[model samples]
Target: MNANLKGAAMMVAAMAGFAVEDMLLKSAARDVPVGLILMIFGALGTVWFAALAKSRGDRLLNRDLLHPVVGAKSLAEIVGRLFFVLALALAPLSTVSALLQATPLVVVAGAALFFGERVGWRRWSAIAIGFAGVLIVLRPGVDLGWGSVAALLGMLGFALRDLATRGAPKSLSNMVLGVYGFLALVPAGAIMLAVTGGAGVPPAAALGLIATASVVGTGAYYALTSAMRLGEVAVVTPFRYTRLVFALILAALVFGERPDLLTLLGSAVIVGSGVYTLLRSRRETQTAAAQEI
Candidate 1:
């Protein structure tokens, strides 16, 4: 397969990892502090990503992960992961997944600001309507709650994380970047553990399941970044909706959580809008490439 297709495949795998990780975290949240669970995920991320780097022949001996730009990107990711975990912990998986559907919009805005990328009227329109879909999912003022707030903040934070990762040096692989991201979280996790009266060990079975989730997540980060880079950000992003399908199914199976009609309808709108944006972006990228040729 071509490199780009390989990247998309990796990204799809990453999304699957993300789905499983979210499920595990949501479940573990019931028995453990949110802080502790996230911290554990970070720890797992650090070790697994570092190993991936070494195995891939990416050196891990850099004084820093290649300047402040990469460092900033990794740190942003740490913050994003923390917020995402808390969001999932406190809210329904379907809702958090749906809220995260807003990510493509965030990416478009970030590209315009950071990379001097241009946004045509078409993309801008899709973004606006896509956010409207988010509002539909949120229906914020009507059903105001902490989970909504957490999901919103988490969405924004992850957006930043994604943006920062874009400018990282080509020398560093995703594995290296992921390693630093998790390492950045270590101190933060330790601090939280202290604040939470030390880690409260949950059932061994739960802990094991969570550990597996963390491992998949560590690998998934690389897949996701690869996907974003391989395809047009706008185009490849709609594939993220696949997570919602997994989440909804798991939510029903694991939690017996049934979403109401409004939720499903809103999610459909949000996802459909996102898919349109992705297709447009992909077409645009192709047109741009053809022009260059």
Candidate 2:
């Protein structure tokens, strides 16, 4: 298979793995506290990523890990993981996943605002439409809930994380970055556990679920990294949307979730806007390259 095909396959596989991880975590959350689930999952992921980094001869304690950009990334990771897991446990999986589809759109707007990247009016309009879709999903005056708010905050946190990642040092390997990302979950979980007082001895079934989720989540991250490396980014990145498809399916099968029509419509709008933005960006990049030539 060609690079793009392989990358697309990897991306799909990664999405499937992530959907499964989310399912498992949600299941475990029934028996285990959300904070405890995060602690165990984060601990396992930290070990897994650290081992991968060691195998690659990457230093786990590099000074670059202390860089301001990395600090920002860590903060964002904490917020993202904490709220996202909360949403998974509290909300319908389909709705949380659908809201997550807005993350890349947020990242695009952030890039233009913070990185000084020039975004044309068309892309900005797409971003606006994407956010409107979020409101549709939220339906502010009608039926907004804490679950929806948590998912929205989680999406914003993740977008900020992606933005901070852009400023991270090139010297940090993906594995090392993964280590820090997972490591941040420890404090995030601890803080929440303290506030909620949900700490308890998790049952064997919960342990099993958490372990399986950690393994699947780690593998998904690796596959995502490989996909990005293996293909033209513009070609591979759009496949990230497949996660929502997988999540929707899993939500129906595992949780018996039946998303409302507005949720579906909003998800469609978010995905369409994101795709348009990506394609527009690709076109502009090509135009710039042609001009340079």
Candidate 3:
């Protein structure tokens, strides 16, 4: 298969994996505390990534994990995963997933502010429109509840993680970064569990669900990493939006939750703006490269 096709396939598979993980975690959340779910989920992920790192002859504990950029990345990872999982447990899967799609827009805006990237007025307008889509979904005057807040926080954390990752040192392998990312989840989960009156005993069925979430979530991470590495950025990046499709399907079939028209409209706007931003960024890069040549 062509690399682009393979990458698109991988990206789709990753989105599917993540959708399954969310479904499982949401199921488990019926009985287990969100924090305990995260603890087990993170533990499994940490072990999985650590083993992979060892297989590649990478050191498990390295100074790279402590680098300022890496530290910021790890912190963002914890916040992202922790709150996202919480949102899954508390919010309608479809709504939270729809809101989560705004991460790339957040990243674009953050890059412009923090990295001094030159975002043209049009892309800035897209970002503004994308955020307006988010507001439409959120409906500020209405009491949308904590789930919306959690989802928004999760998006911000993820955007921060992506931005920091862009500046991370090349010396750290993806596997090493994965290990640190999962490792941060452990303490975050632990703290959450403590504040939530300790971890309650989960039913055996919930334990099974948590285990499934862990495996599928880890697979999603690796699949996403592979997609970005293998495919052209523009070709592969749009596939990330497909997660919303998979999420909506699972939400309807598994949870019997149907999103309203407004949510659908909001999601379409966010996706449209995000894709435009990516294509425009890619065009600018190509133009710059041509001039340099």
Best by lDDT: 2
- The C-alpha lDDT values of all candidates are 0.78, 0.91, 0.88
lDDT of 2 at 194: 92
Which pairs clash in the backbone of model 2? none
* Candidate 3 C-alpha lDDT tens digits along 153-244: 99899999989988888777788888888878888888989999657677899999988888888789889989998999989989999999
Per-residue alpha-carbon lDDT of candidate 2 for residues 1-293, written as tens digits (9 for 90 to 100): 99999999999999999999989988988888778877888899999999989998999989898899999998998888888888988899999999999999999899999999889999999999999999999999798988889999999999999999998999998799889998988878888899889788899988998999999998998899999989988899889999999999999999999999999999999999999999899889899899999
Each candidate structure's TM-score, on Cα atoms with residue i matched to residue i, is: 0.88, 0.97, 0.96
- Name model 2 segments beyond 4 Å from true: none
Which clashing pairs does model 1 show? 235-278
Cα error, candidate 3, residue 115 (Å): 1.3
Worst 10 residues of 2 by lDDT: 29-38
| TM-score of model 2 (CA atoms) | 0.97
Scored by lDDT, model 2 comes in at 0.91
Whose lDDT is higher: candidate 1's or candidate 2's? 2
Winner by TM-score? 2
User: Mind giving the per-residue lDDT tens digits that candidate 1 earns over 11-103?
Assistant: 677888888888888888878776777677778878888887888898987755668787777667766766777787778888888888888
Off by over 4 Å in 3: none
